[model samples]
Target chain A: MTTGKGAATRLRIVEAAAAEIRERGANATTLDDVGRRSGTGKGQMFHYFPQGREELLLAVAVHEADRVFEGQQPYLDELTSRAAWEAWRDLIVEQYRDQGLYCPLGVLISDVGRYSPASQAVAAQLVRRWQECVRAGIEATQAAGEADPELDADRTAAAVIGAIQGGVTVLLSTGSTEHLEAGLNLCLDRLLL
Target chain B: MTTGKGAATRLRIVEAAAAEIRERGANATTLDDVGRRSGTGKGQMFHYFPQGREELLLAVAVHEADRVFEGQQPYLDELTSRAAWEAWRDLIVEQYRDQGLYCPLGVLISDVGRYSPASQAVAAQLVRRWQECVRAGIEATQAAGEADPELDADRTAAAVIGAIQGGVTVLLSTGSTEHLEAGLNLCLDRLLL
Candidate 1:
């Protein structure tokens, strides 16, 4: 990481790039647009992203992934009780319901070249972080005797995470939350006592 | 649809486009490449896909979606009993596990502009068809007294479908079948009595 002002400039560039990509798509977005949005000069953009567009895109992808995590705040961290889990699930459903389609997944999958190892790493890390939170919640529920003790927390968390991914992906395609709600409800049914 | 030799030529062009897109990404595959691969002239390509690249891509998206179903043959149709369900689930898992990442979802989401009404219609139709088969299986199992009679087969089917989607999407990111298998198993455990 760069220090002080350099780090801030780099972050500004990344944020600007993310916005440009979101609004105009990666293909349509250019370094000039990002520079204009970020108020960064051509030399500065080159200094930060030495490898140019691809490097800048990776940073934008990371930024988008962070937003996805942040979007599932509060409830995501407090999944100890069944109520909290339900809140988290409903919050997810409502977000997709209201927001139409989630873009981070789309951005990562389409714009970032999901098959590429670098982009996949960003997606994998996000999933791992997400799964870890759910796994901790499962453990907490088990300790409280709210969830079934026989269930494996890690794998089950993986299942629940998968459920959300499938649900959201389907929502993106069908513009409906039935799959998302149903998948979460079923996973919650399995988790809670 | 075109007729006789025209229909054959159109299909040949679509198949060639599908193969070209699969080999080279949508962004990289050109109309010229598709025409050359199909042994069709530029005039013929224009005659078939009057709207050009985007129109051809939509057709390619449908072709890819069809392969996704065909890949899960026989079992997909006969998902009546627990054995069949298990077989179908394993087949899905193994396909991803071996094939690395499923491309049809990628094709729809990335290649065809999943946000557009046209591409999404293809994706929605595939999901609807896929969900219908699973719903039928759930109903059949219920009738045989091997599943819960009170379950809403359609929603449950949606959940199961979501599980598969989540599992596969996660697999694409993390290169692991753990989530896919876990999600499917959890849904199956609830479905099969």
Candidate 2:
């Protein structure tokens, strides 16, 4: 299915909105700003997103969710070896370091009135997908006899996710990656022990 | 050595701004909005904070830092027993649950570009103070012979702070306290182990 030029323009608007939201924040970014950035007029933006800011925000939420997993990539997919875990750790650290404290996912969820059901669903789906990937990695490590076989994979996976989030929060607050490094080290050390 | 009414009004303005920032993110808030909420006219607001929004934001930043330590309170001060740790954990959980995912500290730090140099200094001071409290707790626990005697208190404190942050980030993203609980549990568990 070609999906048409109109669909492409709509996507461009959404992409631009997501970028703006990431750079600034959701509440700070306006539709006019999106239109200007995306090269669409005010009328064209409304034509594509009749529901207006709410619809556009939902789209941005989904886009941000997709990027979360996409950014994690092959490292999130494979964690059977120590080398793989180190690679994944490096990727996680680099992602936050490069972004330097802006958390798009956190920003999207912070606004109480801005979240529609669609946005909530996208956020939930993203978490579940991310958790599942971690779970799979834990299972792979267990199967490879690298991690404790008796350790509950689900719990460990949750802990890993929790640690990363905690570390990121600290990074966001202080503009430093030291806390993030500590969290990652603790999780990996626990696994090795 | 009595402070003038001007100083008192300035204090009130800062308090109101901090509350508003806590409820709605820094970017979503405006000087007019803050003045309205604080029951101050533009003239009065400017009279107190001549530099305008940036000065007010810096004031709010300092207020938030105080709140961070104040919220951690007697619990953060007392970590001599296992029971004390549990109480501290409960306090931490309730703090986040009641705050409801809006991290005032994170919000203030996120908009650093819009804040004055004093605001940045306040934030840095807050984190250092927080780390010191954690370090104190670690030292107390070690003195009680609860943790490894030879363990580096600073590093352990850093790890604990990191774990809590990583966990809180997950809680903010998922809207569940489970991750926060897990992170706290893992840290305490490892500390005892």
Candidate 3:
């Protein structure tokens, strides 16, 4: 269980670093800058993150990773029928559209995660968990007889996850959500056909 | 048309910058470092990329973008049959697997392209051209009566592209190609269905 004062300060530092990384990118952000923005001294920052910038970044990566599911919540968890699936699809498109091209976790990973095996594991775990949720939804649809039972839930789930990712990647570049919509539509349609 | 000497020198600069960015991430790479790595003086470096680091990165983004299609080779273009599509799919999985987690284009775009319209344009154009090739393949499949005539060629192609992007993104994080293979399989199956 997390305590009050110490936990709050750590949260503040992380939120500030995440914002700095978002605007300036992880590679460009500095501990001093984070201290300036968070109004925390280096001593206190170090107290919270002893390993320094890398440790703080790893925290941000996990925090941002949590948000990937949090942003699509309730809907991401609800999947009993085709209607539920479509609603979730719409929510995903709108979510990424609202977030625009900047992917916080993606920025963190590219900046720091790619180089560190531990950081990479944080990201890898996110992908695995996210795919599992999608896989569960597919299974739910199949159980409801709304989706084809013959479909491989794990593979379909992976493809669906990939489709959304692809769409998000394109959206980041082109500032358009069409591919996201197209991928979701095509994948969802595949279930029924 | 590019002259022999100038073009070679420019190519060297771009190659050096690209390697640095791949290893260090774009934000961490400097023009001076590129000059050092390429064994060129600052004067020569500026002669080729006077706009400095951003310009050099833009060139690298374009270079990496070209490689995306080039690596696929005649297979990407030869999508006249299911055999061709399958071959391209296998080639893609193998290529990305061999290339591993580091994506130079993704790095360049995230670091510099996200803020600059010109850099974003380079990425947008690459995705557009890449998707166009996929659309052509889908159209060819339909023409050959191998795929469902009711399939929306453009949408399907875009979705497939998104799927590949998603798979690649996961691969970059998790160092696994399962999602990529699943996406390709699911999308290709949809065409025949």
**The candidate that achieves the highest TM-score relative to the unseen native structure:** 1
A62-103 per-residue lDDT for model 1 (tens digits) = 777778778889888888888889899889888878865646
> Who is ahead in DockQ, 1 or 3?
1
User: What tens-digit string does per-residue lDDT give for candidate 1 at B14-111?
Assistant: 99988887676788899999988999999999998999998898787777778878988999888888899899998998888886464665677666
| DockQ ranking from best candidate downward | 1, 3, 2
Backbone atom clashes (below 3 Å) for every candidate: 1, 5, 0
Q: TM-score of every model?
A: 0.94, 0.86, 0.93
What residue runs in model 3 are displaced by over 4 Å at the alpha carbon?
Answer: none
* Docking quality tier of model 2: acceptable
User: DockQ for each of the predicted structures, in order?
Assistant: 0.76, 0.47, 0.74
- Top candidate (lDDT): 1
Say which docking band candidate 3 falls in.
Answer: medium
Candidate 1 Cα deviation (angstroms), residue B66: 2.0
Error of 2 at A17 (Å): 1.8
Q: What TM-score would you give candidate 2 relative to the actual structure? A: 0.86
lDDT of 3 at A12: 95
Q: lDDT winner between 1 and 3, please give it.
A: 1
